[model samples]
Target chain A: MIDVQHLTKRYGRVTAVDDVSFRVEKGEILGFLGPNGAGKTTTMRVLTGYMPPTEGRALVAGHDILEAPLEAKRRTGYLPETPPLYPEMTVRDYLMFVATINGLASAERRRRVETAMERTRVADMASRHCGKLSKGYRQRVGLAQAILHNPDVLILDEPTAGLDPKQIHETRDLIKSLGGDHTVILSTHILPEVAQTCSRVVIINKGRVVAIDTPENLTARLRGAETMFVQVDSAGADATPVIAAVPGVTGVTIAARRDEQASYEVASERGHDIRRQLAAAIVTQGWGLLELRPLRMSLEEIFLQLTTEENAGGAEVPRA
Target chain B: MRNVLAIARRELRSSFASPVAYVAVGLFALVFGYFFYATLVFFAERSLQATQFGMGGPMNVNQMMIRPLMLNVSVIVLFFLPMLTMRAFAEEKRSGTFELLLTRPLTDWQIVTGKFLGAMAMYSLMLLVSLVSILLLFLLGNPEWRQVATSYLGLLLMGGCFVALGLFFSSLTRSQLVAGVLTFSALLLLWVINWTADSAGPVMRAVVQALSITDHFDDFSRGVVDTRHLVYYLSFIGFGLFLTARAIDSERWKG
Candidate 1:
């Protein structure tokens, strides 16, 4: 478990993390979504006990990060933005060294290091020097190092940043698997990663926490207009007019068309659910209602909306 | 202690993995070997001359040969020991491994002391080179072995002071070159402080001479382990390590 209360970090004249507070329950994967220079790394640094916060405090596994930093650090694993690999050390030796410093028993170190290497999928390059590893491998090796000791908490900054699409997928799966065993706080600018892997999302911008919620709720909460996708088999006839005839239908546009089947994106009132009405109307008009589904706003759109609103307002704005 | 040893091992391994160790030890051995042979030949000639003239009995080997040899070694170490510690903290900071280290469960003292030991290990290898020449002196001639041992202890203590000072400088910057230059400048200043003492006021002269890093070694090489000199070298080392810890601690607040 991890708890951060009123955390603030400043570097001279610039405040990197401003009065941000959040809690991560045991076995939960919290996605930290933020743009570059948004204090994501700074917050992670504070949580990992790499540095003390300028104000407030953080607790990891029930230990305060500042007052009992060693205890907190002992229970937490950190993957900095840079991988922190020694160029001269072989990957195995590097992980072994990390294991030692993390306070693993001598007997546990070898097994843990091997397991970490295998889990991060860097086993094949075990003997290669870290300096010779590719960017993706370097990031994986960094991850391997973080989880090597099997710490209770893992703070990963941009864990999937340098990986290719396939590697990203594998990493996300690995992180998802790590959930329910290790509390994870991973920061990234990638929106889909949060939507796909995280149980909850924290959107941070300009040193402030803009929004925090589940990806689904974040998308649904920001949805002002209810939109639906309707595919109608019109049999050579246009079905747009008939759909428009339905009450509460504010607008309709053909999203795509293929031969006798066409899909229309229909917008209705914010609180309206016109699926039943639209489906019945199409059926009564002797048209086949093939498919109907609601389209929630994507996390990408919601993130942009929240961050831009926070930037434009630059003051506390009421949120529902 | 295990934590300290682990970090120390990493430092030593990294130094050996790079060309720095080879280059440093190579240059030190070359210079020290030259010093050894020159001192040996000079002492051998003087001893032969004294015996040939029947001016006195055999020249005292410890005074005439081994003491000067150890003195020259301490001077050569001043030139080379900085290379061993120049990268101790600076390289870790530059490579972002400082994050890895500071975030670990180890305390700042453990990290600092570990690095100190690592540099000392490298320094010991250079000292070992000088030892080989001293051993060759024993194999071929007679010298006070106890005096040689004390001289080595002196060199070890003096090297510890240099190493700790270099670590403090390295902690202040992310540039190895800057660390090396600052350490050399500081060591050189202390090395010559005794020479500068002659021009100072009488009261100031004693303090300046006592402060010279080399001045303490004179007693050790002469086969004396004066606790006064012991306290000075130790306090010098302790102060350097203490400052390094403070520098590392202040980084958190600044960040």
Candidate 2:
């Protein structure tokens, strides 16, 4: 478990991470979402014992990060934005060095090194120098180093920033596999990735956490009314007013148009299955209901709404 | 202690893994050999250096044998110590690995001590290799073994102090070249001040000579281990290390 209370970091007149506080339960994978230049990195650094917070206390695994730094650090693994690699050392050697610093026994160290390499799928390139590897492979090696000690808490900042699509998928799978055993806190601005991989998400904007909850819950909370996206065979017919005229339809907007087809997103009053109603209404109108599905809120929309609402100082009214 | 050793071992390995280690040792050997040979020829011409005035003047055989050797060693170190220490923290910062290191279980002091010791170990190895010349000198001409040992000891201690300073300077910058130049310049200024104090007046020279590294080394060059001089050198090294740790801690706070 990680507990941070009233955490703050100030640089001269500017505050980087300002009076922020959050907690991570054991075996929970918490996604830290924020825009660029936000205090995500600073907050992670403080929790990892890289720096002390100016005005707050952090407890990681029952040990204070400031008062018992070593104990706190011993149980944590960190991967910064850039993979902190010694260019001259090979991937194998780097992991070994990290293992030694993590206080692994010799026999256990060797085993852990191999295991980390295997887990991150960098075993094939174990003998390659880290300096010569591609950015994607370097990220993998960084992940390997972070997991080398089997740390109870893992803090990764922008872990998949420079990876190819295939590598990103594999890295997500790796982080997901670590969820049940290690408390993982990963910070990234890529919202969809968080929706796909994280069990709980924490949205931070301007050095403060604006929202924290399960991804589903956050999306659900942000949605004020039921919404559905319906595609029909229009053949040059306008579907916006027809969709709005459906029973329980509160609002209608033309989302897109293609050859012989038009798609409309319809919002209905609360406690309404607008999908079935819209499909029935389209069918009765002699329009072929091509596709009708509930309008699920994407992580990007939730992120922008929450951050903007926090800045505006108004109660965030989750609107569909 | 284990963590310290782990960092030390990695640092030493990195030193040798790069070309800097070889270049430093190779240049040191080349320069030291040139000086030793030139001094031997000069000694033969001057009838084995019958007399040479030190700071107090009127030196003995051991002083004559050891003073020249230590002076040459010190001069060589003025050029080489920076190479050993310039990359201590500067390279880590430049490569963005300093943050990686700080997040580990090791404390700031441990990291500083580890890097310092790593540089010292490499330097001592070079000195050990250079000592082959001392053995060769003994074989060729019967030099005083006691004076030679004391002079080497003094060189080692002085080298340690310079390493500390270089490490501290390295922590202050991200550019290794800048760190290297600054370290060399700092040592050269000390040497210049030491010599200038000799030709100048009493009061100002007293202060200058007190700060001179050569002054503390004179007794060791003459086979006398003054506890005061040893204490001074040790304290200088300690002060440098302390500042290095504090500098690293301060960066974390500000970063």
Local distance difference test, each candidate: 0.91, 0.87
List model 2 lDDT by residue over B33-68, tens digit each. 888777766655455344442233443435555477
Model 1, global lDDT: 0.91
User: What C-alpha lDDT, on a 0 to 100 scale, does residue A178 get in candidate 2?
Assistant: 97
Q: Write the per-residue lDDT of candidate 1 for residues B1-255, one digit (tens) a residue.
A: 999999899998998889988998888888988988999899879878997898778588899888898888898899998888889889889999999999999899999999999999888888887677778988998788899999999999999999999999999999999999999999999999899787999999999998899999999999999999999999999999999999999987777
How far out, in Å, is residue A158 in model 1?
1.2
Every candidate's DockQ is 0.78, 0.76
What CAPRI-style quality would you assign to candidate 2? medium
Which residues of candidate 1, in runs, are more than 4 Å off? A228-245, A251-266, A275-295, A311-320, B52-58
Docking quality (DockQ) of candidate 1: 0.78
User: lDDT score, residue B84, model 2?
Assistant: 93
TM-score, cand. 1 vs. native: 0.92
